[model samples]
Target: MGRAPCCDKANVKKGPWSPEEDTKLKSYIEQHGTGGNWIALPQKIGIIHIHITHYYSSNPIYLSPPIISFSKQINFSISFFVFGLRMFISESGLKRCGKSCRLRWLNYLRPNIRHGGFSEEEDNIICSLYVSIGSRWSVIAAQLPGRTDNDIKNYWNTRLKKKLLGKHRKELQARNKGNGGILKQENSSSLLLQQNSAQQLHPCWPQIPVLPLSSPYTNQSPSFNDQDSIRKLLIKLGGRFSDDYQPILDGLNLQFPHGSNSLSSTQQIQEEQVHVGSSALGCMNSIGHNQVQFGQSNEYCAELVQGQGSFITTAIGEMVSSNDYSRRLLGGSLEFFYGEEMITDNKIMGACASSSCGQSTNWGETSSSLMYPSLVASNYEGVRQEMPRECAFQELSYPGAQ
Candidate 1:
């Protein structure tokens, strides 16, 4: 079965309450309480209907219930109170429902209820409470005396909300236009930093392995001595010694320094420090502590001779000695690059002939300077088409390695 409604919907009045209805509702509630049942209060206020048993009068000869009694003073007050309520129902009488009666008494006709303009303090309080807890109008209403939740809610939706929004927009626009756009700059810079941080953390970005530029242990020359030395170093550096290291560096050898004497002990307790940039000017393997050995007789000279018409030469072409160019290549107070590019009669020809692209350090200047950097260039021209660091690997001969 469906829940029964409190009143008949068709017969009850709605919309604006009449003056007479307001006055009647106010007066009735003040004189006699709603008895905690607003649904019955409407009927009680409409007309007085005393049960024949509750009333007694018969020219001082009326029969009263033998056990029932009443004080004359108390009965008279009750009669007077209901006298106004006992009027007959008319078309012009109050005809509202139970809910309407309740609402009228509580929100409109209640004593001390304020319905005029809200104060600035009230607006501030409303805005603050709304920010903290959102549209809980009843809770907000409790904070302000004499204000109804319905009134505050309507005020916020209609006017107060728009006022706050306009104020916020103006503040943001002024902040942007004044002070050299400081806020925008900080936000943009912070965003850029976050982007860079994300890129650094990306999995696809290559992890740059840390090692001496002249690592010597390449894909071609991994040996046992090198593996053992690296393992000990890693242990000293505080990392786990994995049982699986054998699969990684088990076959590496440790190349000894050239001038070392006979072993003081059976096991090589100490290894020579690899001087990557000190005297190295060509391949790390090929260069020594005090000399560079990049000459015309290097492994790839013949390839260049076959590919290009000329062998590599100094910029001034045999005028300035090779040593001077070597110093410059070593960054002896000055680094060198292709100050001027090589030009040939045929565009297809490589700069293999002692000349090529203009002065550009971008080619091979890794973060750490190569020990045997550009001696290959000084020996011939200032770095021809072949990479100067190729001597370190000493793997392929130039001009499209065979």
Candidate 2:
């Protein structure tokens, strides 16, 4: 059998001290004195000393007499007051470790430490300060009059955290509802764009030889051809790629498989990729590129096809060239695919999508979405993609696979 539990767990005495116990301890200590040692003090004064020592030992105020002086009544053993002086001298910063200093200050030296119930003003201050600083109770108590850090810390752990958490939850719900408005606006804009594109196309749209750009096969074929043209276009563009591409290509050929200590193929690949991806994203987002694509081409069909090809080539080329782009795209795609799969499998798309579709307008709201399912799905996919393909494949195909 296990050893009997240390001390009694249940029925531990709590709340305010009795007047009778107070009177016995106070009168005894006043007459006899503590006589130099805590261990022997109880024995000298009898059971009353033991009871007072135990009571005051547990109460932070008795250990720190300065704080007790703030109270209108003097209701503790005189021995406790004498003990506080010894603790202060031994544990002050002049010679004591941080632990000893903190214990001495908290138990004996700090002043005006209120031990009774917290007032409404004190509660309000704690709640408001906690919002910005979290569990810095020592800091919180410093702001309030007559309140000790220990009391504030206890009240926060037992009471304040729960209230704050509930308030936080309600704030989140309101913020999410606000974000849902922005997402609905974005969805509406996308639908409007689709409608506008439809109006621009021929009425015999079904018969027209048109394929969706979103389709992988249609996207891939043109991307393969445009990859060759992309290198030529980069040459004509006169940017970092135009300047660096030839030198990088020459470096690659010279350093095929591996290079000398002077220049490595791996380093060349990294430099070239960063240059390419930065260039592509910059050029695509520019006003100049948009004007050139739309203005130079006479036929709408030709412009659309060429523009789509350019985008696909830029995206794929950047991915192949830049490790950063590859990792980001791969991770993003994986997360998107996995999340879609999970939602499909679980059949919780409507509810999940509704929650996921919200877009925060403020920094605080956006920060909160870090814990949302949509963000989690996105991050999971992104991190998964960044992992080695072998690892990702293993994750994809596991115990369920034959």
Candidate 3:
């Protein structure tokens, strides 16, 4: 047989509490203490614990304005208007359990209660805690002052999860672009292989070499520039160079789930490396790898690394203007062909390298067609696995890292 209800179901009023009931509860509590037993407190006031017979999903029983004014007059602002309304509504003989009453008092009615607007530091702490300890919100809440376990739980459910998911989505999009969009909807492996082979025949751009942290060709000077290090750091951080660079960094960060899931194995890493290498090369026109150099100008590379100036447009424009002969031959500014926004400042002007630049770039398609659910699952696991190693030399820690 089922256990009986905690409170008397026949007598106690239930559902949303009206403003009048709230005022009565608040007034009595201020004048006289709860008398240690919450179960007996409702009857102490004139509010009767009558059973709620009718229920309406959209009913406006939570009328707050009149009660808010009454609360202000009594100086019961310590409870906060919303908190006082909910707390007394149940405990004031409206049908709610003693346990719920206690919870409301502790979580909402408490004097030191903190609510609304989690700071960035708070966000990071929450994310880090979540990463380290899954969803033990009570434990997480302890680290944050004035934050209740319920608040953290609700925040995580409603906001934080979506933020993480969005990060994963952007990473996946980057990887997909890096992978030549091979991760598109394909049922079978053979078709994927066939598409992969087809893509190989048409060389779009020169390869971006992934180099190790230390190289023997080092001119060991007192202050030597590490362009490779800077590039690796930027890419791994999802276009973020540092805290100040967040605005330009956009939807980028070094957030990848760790442990055995999608990207746990060495084979997967190698596959992703190969895919990104080829796909990054595929974004540009056929230029021999040695002939094409990115940011040959030390000044420009430094600016790019430091997140200074219109580094994106300048770096890319310089590379294309110097290396691509076909672009110069086309005889128009690069901005004319690819819009002002993409060009960044319109300061560096170069011609369209390919006659089919408009056709090949397909700017709208590249920017718009975002790959979603696939980026979130096992397929995205490799990104997580790879990112930690991308800047493995440096001590970088963020949420969702292994």
Candidate 4:
């Protein structure tokens, strides 16, 4: 056999709850806590027992036997609800189901139930958590103290989602404008590598590569406030850029997942050590080895450690900036690399002065590259790259050190 219904469906009132009903439900729950029974709760308020439904339909319920006690089930504060306004049934009880009374108190009449006015902080928390956890509204609601799961779900569907989508569209439009707009490159700094390029072409004027209009923004959807962190990082690593500084950073935007399924991209430039996306720039680590690698091409590579004033040196301490003044103003962030196979031909790349740490520096010919910025550029007198090489301590331009 199946379970019986909690109450008589037709006898119960239905529709918007009246203030009287609200007061009754709230007061009863506060006082007795439903005594753990919804059906019995309303009866406690003054419901006359309708023992015989057929007898009450034709005349007075008193003709039927009175029901002093209800069937099984206990210990839950419950009340039924509906859309109706009427005088309080002082003689009869609230005509609502157990579920209705529970919902009325939890959703509306309860204290601290925020109806609306979601703040920007709440919005970010919602957006970030949603991006990470999807449409888990109950879980999301738990994060917002005064918010309810239903309220959040409805808000996301009706408002917040549209807001994010509109912003996403604006970003797309702006990105399109960039394809043929503000980013036209106008200068290039060919760092003094070995010797400056001697082309009659203006070394100061740059040849910025024109990109197509269809390229998408690198980050999926990042919040606007993340800009402060990004700005600080960019300034810290500002000198790290060669000529492509504008373009690379231009592509970087802090992103949140614009769509429920879109992936969130995370980048960190503020760490004690710098890291960014590029085939040419990378940091490597092993048991006791830490190497920062940079190059013009995949086939071309070289190793560098911090040196005095905007410069990097070979694994065995050699001035990367082949000449004098170029050594100070721009350091050795720029380098000329050759192939490992040519280590003995003496055709290119300076030979190691005195091999340190029993390791040899190999230089491969690459077309374009830039390395780490001077750590303590303020005092360029010299730098010490934290690596595992004894010769790493030699002073720049020291006898045969270069």
Candidate 5:
């Protein structure tokens, strides 16, 4: 009940086609044409038939069919132009399949078939079409004249994909290098700031005080009336500014200049006009016009006695007198930090005492100038032995809280 064979297996030789066989197949199709039947064409073209062995019954089976009458020549010509030419040659003579003969003619032997290297524009078109439609190489090939789907597919795999990968890898490497350089520069600046701060502290002070030097958040002109939040932040930072360190404002209650009187009371810091510098001591005006308190406190002499052991009088003197140093702290916004090793020495207390002596125009400026020298000076000291264990937040808070 199995279907009959298409051709005699023994007579049909299957493998590479010879030049003579190619010529014969090509010549026959050119002269007489396929006659519309591939199965019969092999016999008509002088391919010998032989018996094929049947496996189930161990018997030989032979298959042959009669050739049909030829169609009208006009119909054949129209079909030939539309479908292109065809060939039917079994492996017995030509050693090539009928399909193989058709492909050889259409791809190579057909009229106006150009074969060679693809141009740059064609390559671009192919790549764009492939990307848009995906790997439908035949569709891409149609857009690119004189190119085959197989050729386009092979070129993309062997050439274009590698080219694109190389470019992408180079871009990625360059991006990484830029990022690495930025990180290196930031680290270097931070280290340099710490070193300079360490060098500024006078040697006489016993324990150092640490401060948050700079961060992105500190660079901005923050909303000023948030004194409640500022106070809370300070309280959270171990009550450094809450009681023990609050400035004793004596006789000086400096009023703000004409238009700036609402500073810190009702008006917020002007964000656009504010510019942050290294120490933040110069930009106090941006904090909004508010009352700045200064005092001459002879009563704090008992309080000064506690820091007398570690206080450097000369260091406090120079620090209080330096308008430049005071200006630097006021130049930027207040930034708080935690868990840095700062030496809490008496030089800071001495500076605070010295600051109380001045009836200053800007109390915010004077207080910061007094506080940060100790903060900066404390950073370089040995934290393991000298730093106290009592406070939860051991580092400096913003000077504005003072």
Candidate 6:
């Protein structure tokens, strides 16, 4: 454009530095002690005048002595200190954004930074706390000295999450095994109790044959006839009289004869009659004769009546007490059932709690006590093939009875 930007003349300054020019510049800088202004010094030193570009620019048409000297001995300490101060202030106030501060600190000023793997104790604490606390890596990191939140978060994602998941799977398996053992113990205890209860009752008691009213006793003596007449009269007056008195007539086995609807409403009278018959029969037998003293005004008969009543009352009381004890055990077991639910709910709530700390969701309002037995029973049934028969008996017999 302007004479092809002028081909370099032998005496003309070149497009690039020649060896001779470079030598000349070096010698001049060495002699001048490397501190003079480039644009002014060239003219003063009788060299061709050259202009130096500003420090902020990329392309330079010429060089200046002052600019070159300043660049060589650049003192960055002040600049770095100012930058670090600003970065810290901005991070503290959360004003300049973490990304900007981190970039400035890390890229330009961070010294002796460790960029390696975490230690074993760090791994263990992280894993355990993570199981209980889930995410909240920042808080976890704070507990682990010399660790950063970002480092922990990354490690958890990449390595710890998988390891912990494996551990949790094993824990679940162990819990299932423990549950199975408990179920087996419950089953064995219930079976043994059932067998013992069955053995305690007289074998012949369950098969008593009903008899007709007109049948006479084997002994046809007048005393026997009078006793039979009294028994018949007592039965006619709504009493429960067992002709066969080989076994203790516990009220539990005193089911009225099959289809004896006439006797259902008169159970109390039947019970009284049975009591009377038992007392009368006891007096006739050798044991009975000795049990009562002659001319003693049947005080033993009265005592026997009182004892029989007490026995009936005691048996009924025992049954009721046993039922209550079973219910309490069941309630305590139900509490354990709810306790498991609470553990599961707590884990869920912990995750939610960590994630929603700043939210107004009222997580504390939830309660484990509200967990009903019905819910746990359903879950229990699914896992167990057959419930402890006694427990099931208790549950079914006392549905809403408790």
For TM-score, the strongest prediction is 1
Q: Estimate each model's TM-score.
A: 0.36, 0.25, 0.34, 0.35, 0.30, 0.23
Give the Cα error of residue 115 in candidate 5, in Å: 3.9
Q: List, residue by residue over 328-389, the lDDT tens digit for candidate 5.
A: 32322212221222113333333333332332233223333233444333432432233334
- Model 3: clashing residue pairs? 11-51, 12-50, 13-50, 13-95, 204-284, 204-285
Say which prediction, candidate 2 or candidate 5, comes out ahead on lDDT: 5
Q: Look at candidate 2 and tell me the lDDT of residue 60.
A: 33
Ranking by TM-score: 1, 4, 3, 5, 2, 6
- Going through the candidates in order, what is the number of backbone clashes in each? 17, 5, 6, 26, 28, 5
**Per-residue C-alpha lDDT of model 6 across residues 121-153, encoded as one tens digit per residue:** 566556433321234465456455556666787
Show where candidate 5 strays beyond 4 Å: 1-15, 31-93, 174-402
Angstrom error of the Cα, residue 338, model 5: value is: 57
lDDT tens readout by residue for model 4, 236-314: 3334322323222232332322441111111111011111111211110110011111111100011322221112123
- On a 0 to 100 scale, what is the lDDT of residue 171 in model 5? 47
Which residue ranges in model 6 land beyond 4 Å of their true spot? Answer: 1-109, 127-134, 174-180, 183-402
Ranking, lDDT, top scorer first:
1, 5, 4, 3, 2, 6
After TM-score superposition, what is the CA distance of residue 274 in candidate 2 from its true location, in Å? 38
- Please list the residue runs of candidate 3 whose C-alpha ends up more than 4 Å from where it truly belongs after superposition: 20-36, 45-96, 179-402
Segments in model 1 whose C-alpha atoms lie over 4 Å from true places: 47-93, 183-402
TM-score of model number 3: 0.34
lDDT of each: 0.37, 0.30, 0.35, 0.35, 0.35, 0.29
Candidate 2 lDDT score relative to the true structure: 0.30
Question: Cα miss at 103, model 5 (Å)?
Answer: 3.0
- Candidate 2: regions farther than 4 A off: 1-20, 24-120, 127-139, 183-402
lDDT of 3 by residue, 1-402 (tens): 998776776767665545555545545555565779787665555432222222322233433222322212221221213423322232233345555555665566555779979976677566544432235567567667799989999997777655644553355457667775345432243323332342354222112222111211123111113334433443443331222222212212221122211121322332321111111121111111211222121121212221323222222323222222212222133333345553432211111111111112221111100111121223223423442332222221111112
